[model samples]
Target: MKILIVGGGMGGTILGNNLARRLAPEMRAGKVQLKMLSASDKHMYQPGLLYLALGRMTPDELYRDQVSLLEPGIDFEVDPVVSFELDHNQVKTKSGKTHGYDILVIATGSRPVPEMIPGLAENAETFYTEETALKMFKRLQAFQGGRVVIAVGVPHKCPMAPLEITFMLHDYFKDRGIRDKVELHYTYPVGRVHSLENVAKWAAPEFDRLGITYETLFNMKEVDGANKVVKTEEGSEAKYDLLITIPAHKGMEVIESNKLGAGGFIPTDKTKLTMEGRTNVYVIGDTTNIPISKAGSTVHYQVETLGENLAAIVKLGSPVREHDGKVFCFIECGKDRATYATFNYTVPPDPKPPTRAVHWFKMAYNKLYWTSARGLL
Candidate 1:
């Protein structure tokens, strides 16, 4: 059996390692083969991008060699898959080579497309990537003190990011002795400040405590960079000296070019983790239209179920279990305080108040992520 895993993001790398270990006997016997194809040779701990933008972490701490995280016996390559010939049970890579597989795992992650919103890319500061995060950090440093309006878009990664950044920025400015000078404002597209109801309930009070004003149901329609104003779909405009936005997201371009799903997300079975109508082809992480927060923890739980099912299929000729939509996310609430939300499909997250201990744990997890990527945590 040949297992081809595409995209070396958290889901692919961890699942690859998990699958490789579970099928070690078969691999040693030459009965099975595992290969991974990724666009980059370095794997980034994406959560760090938030801290990077806040200047809490350096750029060098955000990456590690991709191959170092993968388990042996897995043939890992940097050639990116440009074509997903799912109907033909094969994929074509950037190097013009084709590879066939008995089972395919598509974990190609999503990308933030701030440019999708008119004038957003040119006007607002976003921290979804290394370049953007560093740039946002610089912008934050130079801001003298005025309206720092934050707007959010749909289907973006990390449910708590907007809230997290807001809270962190409150502390950031306080540390700089300018918390009173800067007025922090947040805007969310939904009726509440956060998509998760409990989180919204929790964060609203936090916002009030921090003196952060917010406008809910405020969606980004266009940014008038020339006027330093952002017009919303709701016909409201917010003027800002500095604009920060959590832009919308879409899956990899290959997913779009291959006509996999609308906006590049692959239509995936939420429980089975398989592509719709295709049992042998699986989808995980940000690539799947799973309607969950696209955090590393979501992918981690998805991988837990997927690795088991894949190994079961190889050994027992049948799969076992289903993904329960389990996700665990730590909410960093600045001031050396943090809290977490852990839930599954059937449960809702009821996050407690932030604590310094949890904050330290989150900080420790930043370094321990590589170990977790190796499936050891």
Candidate 2:
């Protein structure tokens, strides 16, 4: 059997390695083949981009060659996928070639869809892509003082990122002795800071302490760049000298052309990572519309379950592992401090509230996680 994996983000790369190692014995027996397709040769450590944007880290620290990272015995393809013919179990690449697979894993992840919001794509600058993010970082450094608004667009990857930006901006201006010259505003479509009440509670006090103004349940509709104003769905206009917005995120166009799910995100069973209504197709990571935080930790959590289940499917033709929607986030609050929050789909009896201690733990975990993943210890 041949397996085709798309998109070499955190989930795809890790899952590819896990599956390659797991199926090595099967490959020796001529029973399995694994192939990974990615659009670029550079593998980006996305979470680190946050630190990079804040000037706390450098770009070299967040990038690795894709060819050097994949596990041995897995074939890597550096080409963009143009479309997927689900009925034929084949994918067409931008290079005008087609590859067929017995099993396909869709991990193409989401990208910023700024056009979803009127004038957003043309007006406000975004930090979703590596290129745009670096540009924004430079702009932020030169910013003297003005009405700086950090707004969250719908279905964003890493739900806490906007909040992180807000906190870091607060700390940035304060250190520059221009905190009073700048007015910070954070807007989100959700009615609260975070979807989880526990997280919102932890974040609320900090926002208040920082004196950052925020609007909840306010969906940004248009960015009137000519007037330096943002209009929300509630008919409210926010004036700003500079706008840093998180644009709407959507799955790869290939997934949408194939009619996979709404916004091109594949619908999957959380436990198995298997694409719903399809046999022998699985999806992991940010490409799926999973009701969980779309972060690297989520990818790591899903990979283990997906590997075991895939192995079970190969050995016994049945899934033997279940996935628990467990996710952990390391939220950087600037000033060299961060917070750690872990949650499962099922509510915990006692959710550990966020604390300063969690901040230190988050910093420590970053070193540990990167070292482990890169085998650099």
Candidate 3:
């Protein structure tokens, strides 16, 4: 059997590496084939981008070549996938080439859709993508003082990213002796500051201590760039000097055109990561409508599970395991400190509350994860 994995992201690359090493003997004996399709040659350490935007890390630290990262035996395709022909069990690329596969893994991660929100295209700045992060960094460097509003858009990757931005901004101004000059506000559509109520319980105290204003359950309707104002559904207006907005996110257009699931996200059995209607297709990462925080760690766990199940299917022709809906995240709260939270559908039923030890654990885990992945630690 041949496996075709699309989008060499955290999920794709990690799973590709795992499969390549484990299946090398079988592949050498002509038992199976593995191929990875990616849109770009660059493999970025995306979690590091948050530090880069905060002026704590450099861009060079986030760069790695995709070819160099993967094992030599895995075939790598550098092309953009334009469509998925589910009927033919094939995928068509922008270059007019088609790939047929027995099993297809969709990891074509989500992207920010700034145009989906009015006035965001013209006035609002963002830090979702690397390009936008760098642009916002430049703007932040030159910003003297103003009402800086950091707003969280719907269905964004990394639910705590907005809070990270807010904390980093507070630290930035404190260092520049302009903490009093800037009025920082964090607005979210959710009923709480953090998506998880347990985290929100801790976050509330932090926001109060930082003197940052917050509005929960307020959905941003439009950004009146001309007047430097943000309008919400509650008929409330917020004036800002700088607008850092997280726009709506969506799955790849190919998935959307195929009518995969509600809002373009593929509906998958949470444990299996298999596409609901199709037997041969499986999806991992942010492309699936999983009821969990869409973070890199969540993808890592899903990919590990997927690799094992795929191996069982190819070799034993039987399903082996189920996903536990486990997710963990390290939320950086500035001051050289962070907090870690772990949650599973069965346990606690809420994000584990943060502790001072979890904060240090987050700092240490960053090094541990990077080192393990890069073979440094």
Best model number under lDDT: 1
Better of 1 and 3 by lDDT: 1
- Candidate that scores best on TM-score: 1
Candidate ordering by lDDT (highest first): 1, 3, 2
Q: lDDT tens digits, residues 208-236, model 3?
A: 99999998886778889999998887777
Model 2 C-alpha lDDT per residue in residues 231-327, reported as the tens digit of each score: 9988888899889887778888888887888998899888778888888788988899878777888888898888777877887888786898888
Q: Distance from true position, residue 361, model 3, in Å?
A: 5.7
With candidate 2 superimposed using the best TM-score fit, by how many Å does residue 115's alpha carbon deviate from the native? 2.7
lDDT, model 1, position 111: 97
**What C-alpha lDDT does candidate 2 achieve relative to the native structure?**
0.80
Which regions in candidate 2 have their CA more than 4 angstroms from the true location?
Answer: 348-377
Task: For model 3, state the Cα shift of residue 357 in Å.
Answer: 7.1
Question: Which wins on TM-score, candidate 1 or candidate 3?
Answer: 1
Give the per-residue lDDT of model 1 (tens digit) for 1-377: 99999989999999999999999999999999999999999999999999999888999999999989989999999999999888899999999999999999999999999988999999999899999999999999998799999999887988889989999999999999998999999999999988889999999998998899999999899999999999999999999999999889999999999999999998899999989999899999999988898899999999999999999999999888978999999999985999999999999999998899999999999999999999888
